[model samples]
Target chain A: MPTQRDGTPVSVLARQLRILDTFDAGTVFLSLSEIAERSGLPMTTTHRLVAELVEERMLERLPDRSYQLGLRLWELAARTPRAMGLREIAAPMVQFVQGQVRQHTQLGVEGGYDVVYLDRASAPNAVVNATIVGGRISLGASAIGHVLLSDKPRAFLAKIVEAGIRRYTDKTPQTLDELVDVVDRVRELGYSVADGFIHPAARGMAAPIYGPDGRVLAGLGMVVPSGEPVNMRIVELLRSAARRVSQQMRAAYIDPDHPHALPGAKFRVLINSSKSSMEYFEGNEGG
Target chain B: MPTQRDGTPVSVLARQLRILDTFDAGTVFLSLSEIAERSGLPMTTTHRLVAELVEERMLERLPDRSYQLGLRLWELAARTPRAMGLREIAAPMVQFVQGQVRQHTQLGVEGGYDVVYLDRASAPNAVVNATIVGGRISLGASAIGHVLLSDKPRAFLAKIVEAGIRRYTDKTPQTLDELVDVVDRVRELGYSVADGFIHPAARGMAAPIYGPDGRVLAGLGMVVPSGEPVNMRIVELLRSAARRVSQQMRAAYIDPDHPHALPGAKFRVLINSSKSSMEYFEGNEGG
Candidate 1:
């Protein structure tokens, strides 16, 4: 994407987006110079655009004259159907599950070859987890990620396997054969478990959330410190929660006002209940 | 901007965004007709674009053929600096407080005339709250919203007040003068208390978090049932957390790598933490 100083193929809107994208989980704010450098725009252009954006409230200038993502973007993004809708429905249920298990609970959706966390909740004293809400993990690495992968066609899985898995820890399954086995287990048991894979000290149990047509929509999982003997109790809890969520989804499907319904389709997928599906799936799967 | 049937001001990108924006805390998915109607685009265009977007994996089509915000946008937005970075720094602190308080804990930043929730953790059995993570609330309404307003100049407050306060419940403060008093008290107490303002059965306590220059960067709050008396212990915990966050902001400010520091500014205001100053000034003027 690099180009001669002024000949960059980047559109003005893309450049502006690039400037915004420069901020991420690691970097929340940046100086004008830093933004210019990261966006690879002329310092003058970056300054002018940044000023305009700030004026539009798309960027906020800190007391020190540093810039961060404007609340406007967040507000606009809040209107995004997928993130906010799923979050609203899943939140209370996630809270319920976290309360019961006192562990790190997360809701993730499949995106390409990875799983992106949309919502995550844990007790203050819960185990530390590598996944953060609004963060992504490889589909081959974490149990939740792999559960999403397992729901996809085998051809898709092969494509992902072809793309090397970056090992986060020694326990991350590196070989394609091992990954295939894991995927099979996820499909067979209707859940997946990763012990000390993503983070050396963390273990996770995850299951798929299905849409009305029985397609996997997302994955829900819980993380805890490693070395806890695998127990049926946790599995049962997660499965029950997942089942409850699925029922809610089915209810939404039958509701005439439900947005997911097609013009004449008999049901809606009910994205909101996906969290409950996660909980229910985990609970039943564990049992 | 509307145009003749032959030509429309709405660009392909804007239409694409509209499809995504149509999904919110309430609307998660929609059929082609709903998409076209809500976005004000023709069915042909909506169908074509939605199909293309689905191909790009930027939108997902369910078995019923309705569309939801594709995981792609969530993935990309996840990389957006504001959502990820602020949450990372704030999560641990929020988690700690939630552990101690066992109530609804939230982090929010001002977005235009509203507050965009970044992260929230609540006691599973805590009071039902209207606030949702990644949702928006009017600036003149909630405790967090007012905390942000407390940092703005008087002229800015006047503009907002003139714009009008959306009353969500009977207890919601309507007049600007009344709101000014609320802001004053928030400043005096180093925090804010919202009683049945946003939702009838809910109340909240919030404190501002500062950036490097001691400006209010964000607001952290908790929600509880309305009838329950204000818990001083939770207030103390929130205040302490806000203070420690302010210290972190200061450290970031002094560091050369801090985003807000200009090359050589003699004085800097932390944008997110200046609520105290604004509140103090307002109180002195008999706000």
Candidate 2:
């Protein structure tokens, strides 16, 4: 739906973008004909566009003539302050939590109707979870997704429900009423629990991470074996970690003038303060 | 420079790409005017191009209107089959090695006169190495860089020497003769080691990984404390680990028809195999 300077429809740009979008968690690379078929463009058009993109280094052509995303894209994405900044601060804390639990720990942000994982860490023996960095899952089927959904406006939630929920597994809550009850529980308990929803053998616990204005900017979660029942102990640990991470995020608000802030210093401050806060709160709250 | 079909001189695309290239390990994010200055383009042209890129989701506008890379780019880069495929097979192995070494583990590919890091994992207590995922380093500087450079032609190495190398620290090899000798050593030993070259307090050892055809595909490395010398014992561990990871990569390559065989799977395989191979070999090798 793009237009050129002469007011003509720039279908080429749209087709090129469509070809790029055809790649996701499920489809990461494609043959030239596969791209042509997926984008519904003529073979010639797809070839030309793919060639132009490759020339610009926006896409890379392998030895097999198939196309994959280019380093240019990765270099560009590294500039996104939200993904880079948030992940930089949250990674050490996530690593610490993963070290203790010896499970999968992830940091995600709500994107439309799903939660997109930005960073993830896992121990070698950790339970298998289908989620990967840059992978997305439905809001109604993931603990991080539910935590994000619980923080949104009621009108938004209503629209999401009306759009229909996907049943990834039998544990996925399908009805609007069920989703509402789950959201309410998440708000009251300060966390969300998903049991075998996205994956049949995985359960997840998640809490919301806030930015400077206390807006629910991202969600932090842990994936464990489904055979282990969800317990208050795990929930409390997640909440405490989320709170500490959020507080650190609030402190390091990337001043415009100081664009080159020391990322390591920021991470150290977050981890140190978070550890101290966890100890102090553990003794005081006894949750 | 790029030309249009009508023979019109169109450096617009090239100029726009230069703006993107300005972002490297040293500069991840930049202000509007800074981009213009670095790209050597007029402010008006830079502004318009940046706007178009932002609209296309190639760049993201921060809360303060400063620009960073976008997730769209990350998603696109995630599709690069060659880099992603190798990383996918190697990540598990890399993670296992990281767990045992409790240091930094990285996977890199040769790019022009530099080595581009595809994936990296570091312990919270690990020595701070000025490298990030998607970042690049000079081929003649670090251990990984040297390993990657060992695969390059002699003319390329001479060109780099003639261009003059920037000395990062006192320990960095400044003379062309010294650099040539080090690269020769790397090719002979099948690995490279650098103490206090890039960073004064870190010692890094890297081994080149080969593909099914025995072509040097990527380099896997470990960065440990400099106080602990990188003796023959450490070098053997890295070489053996790289060899095992290369074997796993060969096994994964036979199935090109696999859906995830694209960028995502490729990346995961490289990272996973590298991590796992390191762990498997580390225990048996007794470093």
Candidate 3:
């Protein structure tokens, strides 16, 4: 029922995309009727468009005659250059964190008002992590979300604030001021901690991971059991891991297009400052 | 120029997909005219479709006004259930292979005639692996490809053979009969070895990983240097890792709809036999 300008029906392409948008994490397999209902398009149009989509391999007909997103679409997304560089470089760091912490370690980036996880490495007995690779979580409900949103524009922050929050747990930020306060602290401390913000017995922590350009490329973090206080040692470990990944990102991104400016040069300032925090943490080891 | 069976023009959906198909790993960004040329569509139609695609976030306009695959496509692809289970469940096993072998470890599945890599973990100094995640490799040119195609139907195999071969190196199988022999060997030996098939100095090895249904789900593999012969120890490592991944895939895939068929039961037969191979290796370690 999405209308176009001048009160006309939406374009054919728009109508088609609506069908694709209907299939989500939960509704991976859907019948033709279900797709029509979710898309809010008529059955005739839905059937025609879906037939075309299947022909294009954008959607695959399942064994039970339902539909799921096709491997062709996944193949196309797999070749995206920006995602390739960030994910390939950050994967080992996330793997290391998963090994050492024995928890659910994830890497994510800002995607509008949510944190879109790019990659995750989970331990065998890890706590439930609501965010999966390619999945998103609201900025107010995730530690990674806080890390991703910390460096965004004030207007962008204001816009999401006006949208109203949907609280998942008692610890989730429920107001604009509360959300901004956490992001401000994340900026100041260069990390975020959210205890039971999504699941009541899970604690999540995150730190900003920068690209070669020293921009906040993604958030690297882990989810742990909330039986004890959040571990400061793990937070330090996460930051150090993020720092190493950022360095590797910088090293790999020396674009021949911009030969004079080294990607790692700008990040040195942050690294130097982080060393002071490392020293401070070392001094307070017993705390 | 794809046409309908009646010799009429294909649908608008097919035309739009042609534009997306034009942008592969080599051609990530293209000018409007380039898109039109590649899609073999009228310039006006290409322009209109690209505009709608940009609006839909299936295709993004670059800063320089060229087009690239949008992040929205990646998000949708990320939620694909089959890829989700395979990548998430198989990642840790791939990571372990990367650590032990100090080489490129990858997971792949048969996509039509080609093997499509699901996920990979690479060592910094590993031999070059041309097939990346979401990228495709011919069944004739990869160890993983052999592992993936071994259990498929004869018609499926015949269709790929009829599609013709594109050789990358001298070691690559050039005839359908040669391809079949290798796949048969892979089936009998419970593993595959393709030395310098894709690249002159690289040795690729693979083993099948089964789904919870005990069907051949994917191929877990690694690429190492072809120096000093293909090491038996690394092959053992790869098979064990694949076996472990198959177990995890089984443990996680218990759907009631699939009752009466014990998940991974057929694969357990492989695992039990593989243990004897492990013992054989342990006995021959001094060799």
Candidate 4:
């Protein structure tokens, strides 16, 4: 494998991507020297790559000469089917859930070992929500993650357990046994309830959303104030919202007249139901 | 300059970016051959780049073996201060405007020669809106652009005119003279009112949002059904929302307690008002 001046066994493209990856939620702006330090690239190489990235408009320079990720990345990412596509189809349902729940409503999809949020709708002065759009939460730490992981195989759950879960709170699952128990409950009940899994003052609940092929595609969930008796009405509402999103997803894939219908593809007419195939849920999650 | 097998003068990073850029709004999914054809790269080069991109999780392979822009791009773009940052700050004001106008409310920032929409809020069953988040509109064609350009220099408008504006409708500004007239009106009124500029059935109105430095940061606007008499009350609502967004933006930069306050930075306090400096608007729009 070829390497840049850093000898990191990375391709030129990977090196460029590495530079971009240096900017995250906390470190949105950085000087070239800070970028060199964070990316571990020599100043000359970082300077060159940063200049090319600026020219390509992937990284923009601030007025103070600091650098940040540019709008070009957002422009490209806006076309992503996994994020924006599902969000567009699920927005109305999420809004419905948010309006009824009067808290935070979110949609998340599986990304590696975490559930990445696709969209979120929150009421003013809602309960504490740590999730942001395009943000991620560990699979063993939230109800949304339980819904996403409910369809995964035992081996996948074992691997996540072996990798070690971050204990967000004492209520978070700490072992494969705990994870499997929660996932099984989600699969059997068609919904999940995680009270104080992340924060002691908030509760999380979610239901699995399915794609056109009857495979689990994402999770629709909410965060509300904890300490109250579990509201079965809200749980039913969440499941209904998830079902609506699933129905919309299926219609988009099966109905040729749908605006989001696949251009030249065929799919099975999946019915939006709480039941899905659990034995064959170990497939790749498509965008 | 190093060239690929297709004899393009693009560097490796540029080639990779070009491949990502091929997936746009209309073309989200593509096969390997389709990507090769669209990117104008040789099949082998396209294959190698696509494989690398998949490994990097920049492009995801769909279940049909086609490819789409991946969630990782969205993940990275989520960290961009220009798009998501501004969108987060301007969201509430946009929502307020949407509530009052009962139409498609939007916030846009200047990108290159176009105005890129950062965020939008629409009521259910609202009038037709062609703009999307992270989408772009020509700077000379809409009321939002007029507010953004109200502070721009005559030479900048001339350059846009020389580039040959696309006539979306007969009501769109066709020459430098017409563009200047509308922009001058916007400058005088602290708001813009464009009737049937983009679509013959809709009208556009916007006001300028200012930054901490008193520079025009964005345009807060709304799209409504045309053919009705202009409602100055709605125009006042739009200006108020823009002012609220500007005040929030200014507060975020100046208040040390603000969650989004810049660390280790100081600047002159800026007051948010309808009036702003118009003589010095010709400068780089920073992220």
Question: Candidate 4: what lDDT?
Answer: 0.77
- Worst 10-residue lDDT window for candidate 1 chain B reads B265-274
* Model 4's DockQ score: 0.26
- Candidate 4, residues A80-197, lDDT tens digits: the string is 7777767766765776677676788888999998989877767656676667667778888878999988888999999888877778679889898999998999989999998888
Summarize candidate 4's per-residue lDDT along B111-199 as a digit string, tens digits: 98899987666664566565766678789997888888987899999988898777878988989999999899998989998888877
Best-to-worst DockQ order = 4, 2, 3, 1
DockQ of model 3, rounded to 2 decimals: 0.20
Query: C-alpha displacement of B109 in model 3, angstroms?
Result: 0.7
Model 3 global lDDT (CA atoms, 0 to 1): 0.73
Please give the CA lDDT of all the candidate structures: 0.68, 0.70, 0.73, 0.77
Q: How well is candidate 2 docked (DockQ)?
A: 0.23
Q: Order of candidates by TM-score, top first?
A: 4, 3, 2, 1
The better-scoring model by DockQ among 1 and 3 is 3
Best by TM-score, which number?
4
Candidate 3 CAPRI level: incorrect
Q: What is the alpha-carbon RMSD of candidate 3 to the true structure?
A: 11.3
The superposed Cα distance between candidate 1 and the true structure at residue A74, in angstroms, equals 2.8
